[model samples]
Target: MRNAWSRAMVRGAWLLASILGSSAGFCEQMNLREFGQPDGLGNLALNALQQDAQGFLWAGTENGLYRHDGQRIERVATQELRRVAALASGGGHLWILSDTGTWWWHDGRLERVLPRTAKLPQDVPMAIAARGDEAWFVTVGGLQHVVVDRQTDSWSSSPVMTAEQLARHPEMGRLASVMLARDGALWAGCGDAICRWHRGELKRWDARSGVARQQWHALLEASDGSVWARSTQATLQLSAGAEGFVDRTAPSDRGDPMHRYPLVEDAAHRILTASQLGVLRWQGQQWQSFGKRQGLPGDGRVHALLSDREGGLWLGLRGTGLLQWRGYGRWESWTDADGLPSSVVWTMQRDGEGRGALHVGTGRGLAAFDAAQGVFRQVPLPHAGDLFGLVPDGQGGLWAATDVATFHHVRDGRGLPGPITTPGGTEDGFLWALASKDGALWVITAGKLHRWPEAGRGPVQAVPGPPGNAQEHFYDACETPDGTLWLAGARGLARRRAGQWLSSLAVEDGVTYVACGEDGTVVAASEAGQAWRVRTPGAAKPSLESLDAPVLKGRMIVSLLIDSRGWLWLGTDAGLVVHDGTHWKLLDRSQGLAWNDTSGHALYEDGDRSMWIGTSRGLSRLIDPSQVFATALPRPVLMSATR
Candidate 1:
């Protein structure tokens, strides 16, 4: 037991060191900066990566395509190009082969290589090979050649292999990969053998030629006339010979670190390969390994590798996002000490004066975040409390909901001492939510609702609860432009206008959130992921339109905010969704979001129009949402000048 305890202690110490060793210099060696939902990567499951001639890195994920310009990352919006299977560069353009079809990205945008009017013989393209004016797409059914007609500036595609040719080469079953060899030969990896096309002649090699008669997943040609093919269990090196190509597999004694993935040649001419265990590099004669001991994340199960022009190695881990090896031996990571005080952020409110600042309600206390300074300043509350809600007090002060009581705090971090108390003065149930309308403060507590007039003379009055079971709980509340109070509750949604409470829309499950849009569009979301976009109340029949955004249809929208530009931002269980009038775009953990559990009423759009989201893990601010959209969002005139 003592020995086991000692071993556990050692492991714990090592983990602590990995997390807290700021001066360890591992950042310089790995130089790894991982990005996901917070940094705007569309998906964590990266399928392919390529660097364009202009030094822009293109990452093809399962959900979207991303471009990195060494400083910022942005998603490239390409229609029907979600599941990228392979990427190739040729003819001064980058060719992207997705599950749907093939696209060419040039001049900062993606355009389909084939015309929309022309349909390919097959729909799913598995691999792409491009050289000079020729490009081949190996689809699920057969091989296709994309032809460019410069005369009409039109594009067309046709099958490369005829029915009789396919019948002759029976071994070309479900082509997996293709590459252009240095000897001007077109090599393809198929299920049963490697097919080579030279001088208009097709040749196949099977196990009789020392090559395994199994699926070859990838094929690459080295500068030294050697061809590398990844088989089901090992990597084989092939060389041209008199009778087909002669091949040899890597040494098996080292546990086969290739992981059935392709071998990538780095700038130094070393072959880099990845497996389920670690990453190995063949330096001509010997193998060098890198894994967790060398600061690689996860089980070292990398799926994609790239050697950039800047002499850095990039590893795309299976589920850990992207990591770069700068070979500098140092690493630095941000933490709560940097600015944020608590990981459990419950609510966020923008400053009323549009000062490019926001106040965050955290599990610890209240914190202020300045967008210009790019830092968080913790505002120590007078008493120890867990803050759940925050709102502008209309007098440069702020109102906060806490476990003990609700207090109005000044802007300079001093909490004024007029504690709003319940009739019983019991501290058992804490206040959970806060909203203000028409000089009246609306507060939701654990047990009931309280309304206090801003005149500072009347006692806190209890508003009649929603007409339902006595135990119905409330989640959020908002006010419309016409002075109507909207409440989200367990039974449904309620609105109180002109001192009369009216039960509005009711759902079987419950309405958990409500946000008032700029155009009097009342967007209310239920616990069951159902959303209704209704116009202003008191009309003969307000049109109730169901939201059809695919990302928000079946997910709980924990947070909702309608920005000034009329874009509806929703924080759901799966990720973040921004609906720009016509389409919805999702940003999730794959995009670098710190946490998916966003707090209700925690979405804030600051003066600079950047969105700050409060989540259970911490606070994340999207510096610019327009960057996600390839086309810029329209801005209102005179508003920019006023700011």
Candidate 2:
């Protein structure tokens, strides 16, 4: 069964990709969040940033060095080592260069490279690069190399290029930036040229070698094994076996030749940098700009940039503090401040036919999104109350349920007088959930379950639920493609097949949500975050298996959805967790979610496959969720172990 599910997921992912296409407008925009003194960084003028082996981010500022572990920032070094210049991490140690001198941090202890009694040259260090037990520093005077004796906690320093070598190649002096490439070669940006040191041979490139003579201030080895050099004048790239570098500067940067932008390569091997205009990404042999028009916060100049292991882009603004861009998808949010009826969104459904407007149910009332104006307009309903359980009718209308009543044929901001009635034609109380499949609508009111036939041609039939507590309330329900109906609520899970209700499947905690997969499988989740998968849902002897995901162990799951791509999305009290068969990833406020606590029955997939999450603060739309599945997973290798 697991193999069959995996095959379905791969097929669905490919189909989804082809359907989405490669339109320019389909690309995700940059989603950025800024952090400042409020987020625990004492200083805003960041000088350098690096990610260590353990995945912690190190930020250097004028005051001190701080460490960030995705949540909070704490000062790790004293204030005496002021004006940190550069940082590099490798071999389980972080090398630091500051105005005072050079230092290395290991196992929470910081030690100066040289004691105050034996100080080295007083020239300011421009950049630092590390590999294994060796670190290199580029300074105004020359390039310095340091080797560490880890066992003895001692180190030795020497000049990489001696004065004789500098005299032979005059253009290699005045080094500014350095990078240790994956090929074990040391690349440096000299004042008037770029140099590569491999083994004992040192090669230089200057105007004579068809390269620009501007001072290169930054160097990076991209994922494609190409070396990129950045200067205030232009940016250049050197391909694997290329003799010289090619000027790949953006056309816009050619006009302003003095803008110094920080450069970093993202997890996707795309070159990323930022100017006063906004963030720029190198794609299709050109620079694509994402500026204030694309929802970037504060127009301050970006000073330091680093791409973390999780694919997030970090920008250290000159004075605006730190900012992180969520790399998966662009998030467009709306709240009361953005013309939403209320900040507390309960449910959402797409209205009309193809690519229709989204109708949302908020704490105050209902509102429809006007994509053209990029704002939500209040759609007044007959009963002014909080709404939930919104599902689309077969026609260009909707079926919505509030606490006191349920309405059908809800169109153009007005609903018809249609409510769920009992067998005696009396109104039911407190409608809780609604589901539609094969033109048949399933309604759960308080504790009673009813089936409303297609187009309301026949009378509503009150169905008998699985035997359990008389007052057991139903919270959610879904119907598989095989005409199997699954219901989840306080008591647990129940299924109905061929008009016959089966016995109740009791879980540890009462199941609160249920979702149907395209392969006739049903996934049910309890409030305690325990989830179970039922295969062959239409069969009399269906098999049940528990989903083992440590990330969802103690989370309070409020909503569950199995998207067309076979990805399971869980809306929980902490955040939104998605499992793509082999891996689980969390998308919270840190990743551009409006809020961590998602609302019940608030997870919806639009006609375009985008996800809409309704939170207490507002609503967020995750554009192009298929991007997360773009990268292929590595195949596993098995090994036999002997006891």
Cα-based TM-score, every candidate: 0.49, 0.63
Give one digit per residue, the lDDT tens place, for model 1 in 65-122.
7877665677886565777757777665788876566787666666787544433322
Model 1 — TM-score against the truth? 0.49
Candidate 2 overall Cα lDDT vs. reference?
Answer: 0.68
Off by over 4 Å in 1: 1-50, 53-335, 350-352, 369-375, 422-435, 455-457, 466-473, 535-543, 629-643
Q: Which prediction has the highest lDDT against the true structure?
A: 2
The candidate that wins on TM-score is 2
Whole-model alpha-carbon lDDT for candidate 1: 0.60
* RMSD value for candidate 2: 9.3
Residues 1-643 of candidate 2: C-alpha lDDT, one tens digit per residue? 1111111000000001212222112222345677788879988878788888767788888778888776688888774577786789988889988878779898888888744443332222237889989998765566678898978978888877778877876555667677888888888876678898887688888887757877677788888878888887678888878898888777655433444566788766789776667666777466766666455666746668887655567887667777777533346555666566777777776656424556767777777655444445777666556665566677877776565545545675566666443442135444344555567777676567777776445777767666555566676788888777788876677877677777677775677678988877688887677888886666666766889989997887777889888889988778889888888888887667777777765677766777877777777777668865567333211000000
